[model samples]
Structure formats: structure tokens, C-alpha cells
Target: MNVSTATVSLALRDSPLVAEQTRERIKDHARAIGYIYNRRAASLRTSRSGIVGVVVHDIMNPFFAEILKAIESELDRSRQTFILSNHYDQLEKQRTFIDTLLQLGADGVIMSPAIGTPPEDIIVAEENGLPAVLIARTVEGAQVPVFRGDDAYGTALATNHLISLGHKRIAMVGGTDQTSTGRDRYHGYLGAMEKAGLPVDPAWRISGPRTKQGGFEAAGQFLALKDKPTAACCWNDLVAIGLMNGISRAGLVPGVDVSVTGYDDLEEAAIATPALTTVWNGQREVGRQAARALLDKLSGASVKPSQELIRPELHVRQSTARPVERS
Candidate 1:
């Protein structure tokens, strides 16, 4: 039996205008024919697209990839679709992506803001009644709900662990004054050193991009120093691995000659030569929370502009150890 589009529509909507027997017959016929409803046509009637946008700063990072997977899984349960874009930590790219998603009629957006981008653009988007939530990293003054890991607390834990291993002259790698995460981790390292009454030398602190190459270059800089630190705290696992490679090139063994610690505990951290001692930030949890916030907004539920911080866990591996002798 062939079913008409109008009959199928009525059946799908469960319209009272259709008799019970007719609706059942239409539904059965539609299913038998493998007929799929046109979501766009349905959206035209209800004015809901059931689409969300996700903007990530670094799509290349495995951690972000994992988080994206979690977001996709959660949204799948609602039969909603998401559009994805990568900002590459560039403000212009982020702005363009957001505008494009808006033009594409995204119901809401979940974003990790580009480094140094002001929140004004996001504010404008929200003013247009577009619900958005910040994930992983937040805009400075945006009223959007934010979900991220506790950077300071995590860094403090890593640094304290190094200190407990009798590493007093510890160096820091892969942080700059640009991003809040970098600044927070740096401050945490400083705070830990201060609490232990350990003096942090200016030469031991290095600033570079949060990339593998950046970590490699920073490690070379540290090796060039006359008074080298026995242990180094890196921004992330990628950086830590890069630093380890550079240390090897400089004729030193990572776990033996110079202990290293990393953050984020990316998958590669566990497979590194010495394995990396790093902090595990709950990236999937951040993604899930951000998705939940955006879904709440899309469902016309009231959601406050609140910040949720997920605690981080330290994974101690073979990458770090106590100094063999005093510096």
C-alpha cells in the first residue's frame, strides 16, 4: 500500500484530525516503505532545527578529539545533529566560524574560545538570542556558561608531587602570558615553589607555544643554561614528550638525567619512552557538561551563566623521579 505525504505527516505528528485506524495504517505503511520524515519540513512547521554548533580551539589535539566524541554521543541520544568547526586558536577564524554557524541556523553553540579573543562577539551572538556555552576555555567576560578543568589545582598537584620527590630546582616549560590556562598553571607552579620555600630562578622559566616543537625549543633553551634544573614541569603531554626528545638529543636520558612532568595526560603520554607523569583533566566530562548546558538552553529551560570546574587527577608514571644528587 502506498501512503501519501500528507497522510504520513499527519501520522508522524499524531494529529487528532486523523482517525486512529488511519494513523496506524499510515505509520505501518511508512515504516514498511522505509520512508524517512524530512526534518527540515518538520522544522519549518515547528521552528526548531534540532541542530547545535561546536567550536574547538585545537582539533588536532587528541584530548579535544575525545571530548568531541563525548559531545557527539550525548547529543545523539536526543536525535540532534551538531556542526563542528576548528578555531585553531585564532580570533578571526573563530569569528568567521561562529558567523557561519549562525547563518546555517544552528540552534545553539558550544565553544572553546580562541586565545586572546574578547567576549564581545559572543555577547553579540547571545544578544541575538542564540544560546551558547563555553567549554575547556572561556571568554573573559562572556555571560555564557563555562565548563573546564581546575587548571590551578591540577598544576599544584603536579608541582607538589615533583617537590615531594626532592626536586627543588624545578623548571617550567610551555606557558605564556597570553592564555588563562597558561597563566594559571604558571602561577600554580610558583605557588607550590613558594610554599616549599624553594627559590624559582628566572632562567629556569621558559615561555613558548603549547606545541611539541615549542616544547622541544624550550628544552634546548633550558639545556643551554649553565645551572640546569633537575626536573621540569611541561604544559601538556605533547610538550613533555617533545622536551624528552630534545633532552635525548642533548645527550641526556629523560627519566634518569632530567625528570619531567606534564599535564592533560593525553593518550600518547602513556606510550612515551619513559611514560609521562601528567595530570588527567576530565576532558570528556567538560564536553558532556557543556552539551547539557546548551541542550537545556535549546529546550527553553532556564540555565544560569555558571562555571563548572572538574577536578584533575595525577597519573604518576616513569617520566619523573628524585634527583640523583643535589644540584
Candidate 2:
């Protein structure tokens, strides 16, 4: 006989409404047949979908890919499915995707907000009774928990390394003064230069899109300068690689003439022609932490709204060295 899961559950629980002999026989048959209960069905019966929504700024970014992998693994362990959306750095697109997820009945959400996204969306998510955790980037006025790597510290380390190599006229390519990560990293660079008593020239700094083409164009601008910087620190590995390409096209060798540094330490950074020197942000660890935080919230656990700042490590490679004259 094909018994329903509810009937089996009733039998297993030995409900007083069921005859003793029938309950015992059903339980014995279930055990013998290795019948397994479906948690999703049970959750649906209790009015839950067991679904989560995850939104990333850019899915093409290797860092985000790693983070997504960790989140998927964690959710799988909890028997929850996730719907992922890529914002492509567009705030409106992000908002639409969020709304769609909510309409589709996601139990909760985790997001890396698009740059310059207002805090009101986060407030709305909370007001709708959907717990949301911010990862990598946090909104200015959002009360949601945030988890991110220490951008300031990572930039400071990169700047100090260049300074130690006798590069006083260093340029920062990529990233604007808009997002908190960009602002903090710029501040860290400024702090390092000031502490070293080096002159900070605004002309050496270039703020633009964080894409490879943007980096290439910025590198061209810097290379055309009458007084080009001896070293350049890019916002991320992709930018650094593009900068390297632009520098080469300008008849300059990357490590030999102008040193380059990048953040994130992505896989391509190490495999590039001159092996980029970069800061490792521990993307996987950041992902794991975000997933854990979201799961805690889903389990009705009291989680304090706090920031988790992961320290970055400097990975030295062929891309940086002391000034040619100094060597």
C-alpha cells in the first residue's frame, strides 16, 4: 500500500488516534523499506519555502564567484535552495531583482549592494520581515549586518610596500571616492604617504570605472603625463592586468620601468605575464562567514548587527621592485 508521508509521520509518532496494531505495523514497514521524510514538503506544510535570495554586484568577478560557491555549499547543507541575481553594478537592476525574489517568496536575502545604493531598500527588506545580510559592501545608513575584508589596511600595506621601494610619485588607478571600500582604501593610501612625509599629488591619482578598459585608458593618461608615476596601485587584479597591457603598448616594461600592485590576488594575477603583486582578501572566508551569518538569522538565532573585517595578506610577486635607479 502507498502510504502518504503524513500518515507515516502519524504512525511513527504513535498518535493515540491510530490503532496500536496499525501504528506498529506501519512503523515496522517504514523502517524495513528505509522510508525517508522530505524536509521540503514538511517545511511547505508549515508555510515556509526554504528558499534564499543572493544578489552579487558582479558575477564575472572571481572574488564574487568564490563567495557564491561558499554560499551555495552552506545552503545545500541546510537543505535550502538559493536564487542568485547579478546586479551588474546597476542599482535599479538590483532593486528589481530584490523585488522579484521577494515576490517569489524567498525566506531571506543576502546581498552585496550595488555601489551607491541607498539604505532605504535594506530598511524595506527588514520592514517586510525578510532578514537580509550585507556582504562585501554595506549601505551607509543600513542597519543590516555587514561582512567585508579590511580594504583600508590592504591599501595601506600596498602603499607602504611601494613607498619602501623608493616610489614617492605613486599613482592609484581604478576606483572612485564613492563607495566606502574605495573611500577607505584611498584614505589608507593617503595616510601612508603622509606618514612617510611624501608629497601627495592629485595629478597622479585617477578615479574611474573598475573595468579592464577603464584601467587601460587610465594607464594611457598616466603614461602620457610629463611626470609619470614610477609605481601604480590598481583597484583590483583585472585593472592591474589592463594597466600592464597599456604600459606595454606605451613602450614601457611593467616591472622594469613602472611597478604595479593590485588588490584581491585573483588567480589570473599570479598567472599573468609578469605575475601581479597583490593583496589577498580571502574571498572564500568572507563567503563562509556571510553564509553562516545568514543561516544563523534563518534559524531564529539572535545575531547582533556588526561588521566582520577580514585582514588581507600581501602576496609578493614579479610586478613590484625597488626603483631602477635605487637598485
Candidate 3:
């Protein structure tokens, strides 16, 4: 017990200032004494908590499950403690989480910002020393590293696929214009429709549904359209699946009487009742790269504030087919 407190402190911190043998001896003795390292105090001293924040729309959503899994894997390798939250597209809830992270001295944040999230919100996080990396969604004018699939292109692929199947009357289900993601996806669908020389009925664009339940409820609305669509290109797999369920309840089978295509090729997409045909939006890649970039920032590396757009691919499944010709 004659060791100087300075030597003990250095040894406890695993500082190279102490000899290897001395450091090991101190650690062993400290362990025997049941001494607990005060990470909070240490964090207060070094301003590093070794904590990261990850907030998504809804973790329960299958669309985000794959992305979160990939992100968890990447952050685990760096031994970072990640705190996850669901904002449910609520701006205040998301800001509250960000504030909590800032107060707790979190090193960085990876977020899929909620709808109506402003660039200033991200800027505030950065100004307060919480660097943010965007995934799945983007805040306009936010100068931060954003890693997400090319949503516009992805939706276009799905729309074009339906067009090829000879569905002139296609309905776009789910999503709203409050977010960049929503606008991009809708524009993608519009682009494809125009390219195919198909008339886009204003009623065909149904917005404000981003979940399975929402999509299920939209089924009746879709069915009530003056010129009912023979095919529906859903915002995501959840909506697509839900709409199919609603359709089935109405005594209609998906992929037969009505063709459907979903975005985000979630695992369940392949195993849905009819096996969904969807666009693979690179969820895993987006998560992995976003996490890696944030970790790099935490390591004192300079990251270019640019968009890393991962291209999407289409997976044809049983959920879609040529629309049946009406007599």
C-alpha cells in the first residue's frame, strides 16, 4: 500500500506511464479490494462517455430491424454502448432524446430523423459536441455524413416493375410529404408513371400511412377509388403486407386479382402470404456505413459531410404479377 496515489491512478487508467508489471499488480490488488471504476467521474474528467445514441422511427418495424442489426454489429466491434430510442416520427420526442444524449456526454449519434426534422436540429447537436450521422432519412441543409439507400431510385424500380407488368392504373399507398424520404419516394413513383405514359390520378396518391395498420385501413379507401387500381406500389413491406391482409379480408387475394409491390425487402417480404416482391434498399449497408462513419468521427477522424447513397435492387417475388384484364 506504499504506492503513490499518482502511480495507482495511472495504473487504474491503464496509462503507459506505469510499468506493465506495476499496472497488472495494481489492477489485481484493486480487484481484490472490490474497487469499482467510476466511469461517470472518469467521463466528467475526460469528457468521453463511450456512449452512442441511435434513434429510429420504430424499432418494432421490420424495415428498421435489419438496419439496426447491422448498426449494432458495427458499434459492438468498437465496444461502444448504444442507447436506442423510437421517436415514432415525432420531432419533440426525437429532440428530447438528443438533449438527453448531450446531457449524458454521448460521443456521437446515429439517427433516422423524424418527419419535420429541421437541419437546425442536427446543427444544434453538432454545435453542442454531439456529432450526428443520418441513416434512413435526411434533414435538408444538414451538413453531416448521411448514409441511406437511394430511396427515389428504389421506389422508381418498384414502380417500373409494376408498369412492366402492364398495370396502367397503379396506386401508391403509404407515406407523406413531410419528409425528404416521403417526397423522394412519391416523386420516384410519379417519374415512373410519367415515363410509362400512364395518367396519374390525384386520387391514386394516398399519403399519411407509413405502417401496417395504416396500410390496412387504406385498403377501403383504395378500393373506393373511381378507377380502382389493379396494382398498388406500397411505401414499404409493412404497408404492402397490411394492404394485402385488408384485401384478403375483403375476399380478394393479392398477387392475383391485384398485383402489389413493396419497398424495402424486409425478411418477412419473402415469407409473406404471397411472398412480397420488393426493392432491396440496402438497409444493412446503410446501417453499417453510418455506424462506421460515426465511430470514425469518435476516433478523431474527419468525415466528409456528404451523402453516401447506396443503390437499390429489385427482388421479384410472388406478391406481384400482371394485372388481370377486367371484362
Candidate 4:
């Protein structure tokens, strides 16, 4: 009660300048008196909104949800507020979100950049004082700290696992070539096929599906291929699960009649109709590291612009098996 006006102000705002005991005492007294601190006023005074932005492809997707959970946990420890957005691979939507963050003076952003996101977009955000960290996907010329799983390595693990099960005619289902992630995953599948001395038919690469519905819809096309693939290496678990469901709809037993492999061992993969064989893409680690890198940048630490790739592991399950002849 005898503290200077400045000390009272700092105490109400939870600033460390106030002693812990005094700060708690002041807070308790304020609560007793029904005093509410004005966060907006505090933000204006300190020039820090305490807000960080996280934009990803889709929040509903379990893959991104896992990453976001990790990010939220890390940011919670720092007592930083975060704003989340889904660009849905739309460049314009992503740009709009970045602009909004800049206008609101957000401290930083962690993004799994939208498809075709130019490097300049990332540069512009940084130049305007919003430091950037990339996750999941990469913009070729963006010089920012990036945290993601080794896509090529992860998909390669899935492909190789299917190959090990004696699947020679393997198809890569889901994902497009528009984003770096798509390209890396496809290349991983391709490389694994080549390395295994398996002939890759052009039709085996089914691009343009990154969702469960997309995968489900693509099932007919997949099944209709003249040279039927004995196994499918899906873009992610969602797609693999969807494809498996479609396989069942078509009266074929997945894992028995047709084997399927998925990337990103999301939580649902294990409980899928036939437990999915998948690659552990380290989504949580990527999210945690990306959030930490951005927080470091906000704390005035020098974060070098580099690609940090978390190594991936393969988890074998019921959805994959040796090739069975299909009439």
C-alpha cells in the first residue's frame, strides 16, 4: 500500500519489476475490490500485444491439431497469447492473416505457409517487425527458422515398409505438387520405389488430394487403374484412413485384399478400422520447436535461419501386408 504509483501499475500488469509477494498482495486486493486490469492499455504502454500468430493449412486436421496443441503448451509456459488461422493452402487468405497480424502489431508468427507463398511475403512480415518461423512446409527463398519433420525420409519409410511387404506395384495417393511438403513426400515415395528396383507407373502417382474426403473420392479412380496397385502409400493418416474406408465400401478388405501405408502417425491412425501402418512425422516436436524458435526471436535471441528436420520413424500396424493378386 505504500508503493509508488509506478510499482502499483507494474504489479497490476504482472510485470516482474514488482516483488512476487507484493504483486500477489496487490492482485488479491484488486480482486477483492473488483478491479479489472486493462490488457489493451498495458499492451499499448509496453508496445507488446503479447499475441503470436499461428497459421496452418487446416486446424480440423489431426496433424495440425497435434502441432497446435504443442504450440499452445509452449506458449502457455511463456504466458503469451496466440491467434490461430487456417489458410487452407490459399495464398490470399494467408496474406490477409499476415496483414492483420502486422496491423495489430503482433509480436511474431509461426506458419506452415500456404501453397505458392512467395518468399517476399515472409520477408515483408519480418521487415515490418513481425519475426517469422515456418513449420510443416517451406518457402524456398524464405530465410527464416523452420521446424518440420523430414518429409522425404518419413514417406520413404512408409514406402519402404510397403516394399518390404513384397508390394511391387505401389501407388502414392493424395497430396499435390503445389507445396514443398507435397513435392518432398512424392519424391520420397518415388525414390523409395526406384531404390527398390520397382517400376513406377505414371498413373500410380495420384496428386491433388490432401483430405479424407479427397482420398475417399479418389478411391474409385484408384481402383479403376488398368494396372491395379497392390499397395497405396498415402499422403497422411487421414487420407489412408479414408482410402481404407472406401476400400471397404467397394467390398474389398483393406490390409488383406489391398494394403495401405500412411504418413504422419496421428492418434486416430491406431484406432482406424484396420489400424494403419504409418510414419511418425513428429508433428508435436515440430510445433514445439517452431514455437520456441519464434519465442527466442521475440526475446531478442539471434535465431539462425535454418531447416531443422526431425527424423521420422515407421510404425507398423494392421493396414499393410504382402500383395494379394487382384483379378
- What is the C-alpha lDDT profile of model 2 across 250-305, one tens digit per residue? 89889889999999988899998799999998888888888899899978998888
Score residue 277 of candidate 1 by CA lDDT: 96
The Cα error of candidate 2 at residue 319, in Å, is: 0.3
TM agreement with the true structure for every prediction: 0.92, 0.88, 0.96, 0.94
What value does the lDDT take at residue 212 in candidate 4? 87
lDDT of 1 by residue, 74-179 (tens): 8998888988888888889988988876665668888888888788888888876568898877677888899999888888999999999999889988867687
Assess the local accuracy of residue 51 in candidate 2 as a C-alpha lDDT between 0 and 100. 85
* Candidate 3 per-residue lDDT over residues 2-109, each given as its tens digit: 799889999998898999999999999999999997889889999999899999988888888989999999999998999999999899999999999999999999
Put the candidates in lDDT order, highest first.
Answer: 3, 4, 1, 2
What's every prediction's RMSD, in angstroms? 2.3, 3.8, 1.4, 2.1
lDDT of candidates 1 onward, in order = 0.86, 0.85, 0.92, 0.91
Give the 10-residue window scoring lowest on summed lDDT in candidate 3.
175-184
Could you tell me the lDDT of residue 215 within candidate 3?
86
Cα distance off (Å), candidate 2, residue 107: 1.8
lDDT of 4 at 131: 98
Q: Candidate 4, residues 79-159: lDDT per residue as tens digits?
A: 999999999889899999999999888999999998889999999999999999999888999999989999999899899
- What is the Cα-based lDDT of residue 151 in candidate 2? 93
